[model samples]
Target: MQDYRNESEQFDRIVSIGMFEHVGHKNYREYMNVANRCLKDDGLFLLHTIGKT
Candidate 1:
């Protein structure tokens, strides 16, 4: 995700289904930040993860 940081190339939408769980708790902010940087202001972000019951 670091490769996406500060990049001029951005997307109109991003989907992270089943991926955020693998990022771990420690890197959540950084991971999301990277995605944020890669998304346009009016873009949409979709995140899906399995929760423990």
Candidate 2:
């Protein structure tokens, strides 16, 4: 996944919805790296997560 993101830089905007909870804390950095790499300079990134009481 890292390699793909590193090479592709192909997204101008990223919208990830409802996918956060599955990513454990140990893999958060990996998730961030993918987002950071996929985003174009000055591009927009949106993330939506749900919370439970």
Candidate 3:
């Protein structure tokens, strides 16, 4: 399959609900990088993750 990261279009909004945890710490930077690249200058990015104490 083709890599999606190479896609040219940017999104106006990106939402990550219950998915951030799966990205892990090691890949967080890379994940954010992709998110940044995928988002338009005026776009919005939302992240929702569970927290435990």
Candidate 4:
């Protein structure tokens, strides 16, 4: 997954399944930036994760 955002190419759809919870709260922006860089201008992003329970 670390290798994904480094690519110059962008994707039409990006799905981050069960990974968002791993990153700490303070790093959310950075993590989202990676996704933004990987996604295209007209792309779709789906961040699926379970909340505190």
Candidate 5:
């Protein structure tokens, strides 16, 4: 688990558009790991979330 967390910070950029909806409450942390690893120290990250109606 720690290894995955450490590896997540190797990306230059990350996007989470429309992904939050698919991420269950139980797996939110794991989902975040994806972005965390993907984003670089100075990389740009964008997130777009749509409400479910």
Candidate 6:
């Protein structure tokens, strides 16, 4: 897998809208780890995904 971390500058805030569902459970931790790596200390990460009834 490619390392996307070095491709961008650290962010103070990261937002994911309607994207987590595509990540699935198996890779959620990895997703978060990448998000964490992309974020700066004291940064904020927000995730908005649809819920099943």
Better of 1 and 5 by TM-score: 1
lDDT of all predictions, in order shown? 0.82, 0.75, 0.82, 0.84, 0.69, 0.82
What residue runs in model 4 are displaced by over 4 Å at the alpha carbon?
Answer: 1-8
For model 5, where is the 10-residue window of minimal lDDT?
1-10
Cα-based TM-score, every candidate: 0.78, 0.72, 0.78, 0.79, 0.61, 0.75
TM-score of 5: 0.61
The candidate maximizing lDDT is 4
- Model 3: residue 37 alpha-carbon error in angstroms: 0.2
**Residue-by-residue lDDT tens digits, candidate 5, 1-53:** 36334463466667667768776678778867677667777888787887766
Judge candidate 2 against the unseen true structure and give its global Cα lDDT, from 0 to 1: 0.75
Q: Residue pairs in steric clash, candidate 1?
A: none
RMSD for all candidates, in order, please.
2.8, 3.3, 2.5, 2.0, 4.7, 3.3
Q: Clash number for every model? A: 0, 0, 0, 0, 3, 0
Off by over 4 Å in 1: 1-8
| TM-score comparison, 4 vs 5, better candidate | 4
**Candidate 2 residues 20-41, lDDT tens each?**
6677668778877888887889
Instruction: Please give, for residues 13-34, the per-residue lDDT of candidate 3 as tens digits.
Output: 9998987787778978977888
Sliding window of 10 residues with minimal summed lDDT for model 3: 1-10
- Deviation of model 2 at 6, angstroms: 8.5
Where does the lowest 10-residue lDDT sum fall in candidate 1?
1-10
The TM-score measured for candidate 3 stands at 0.78
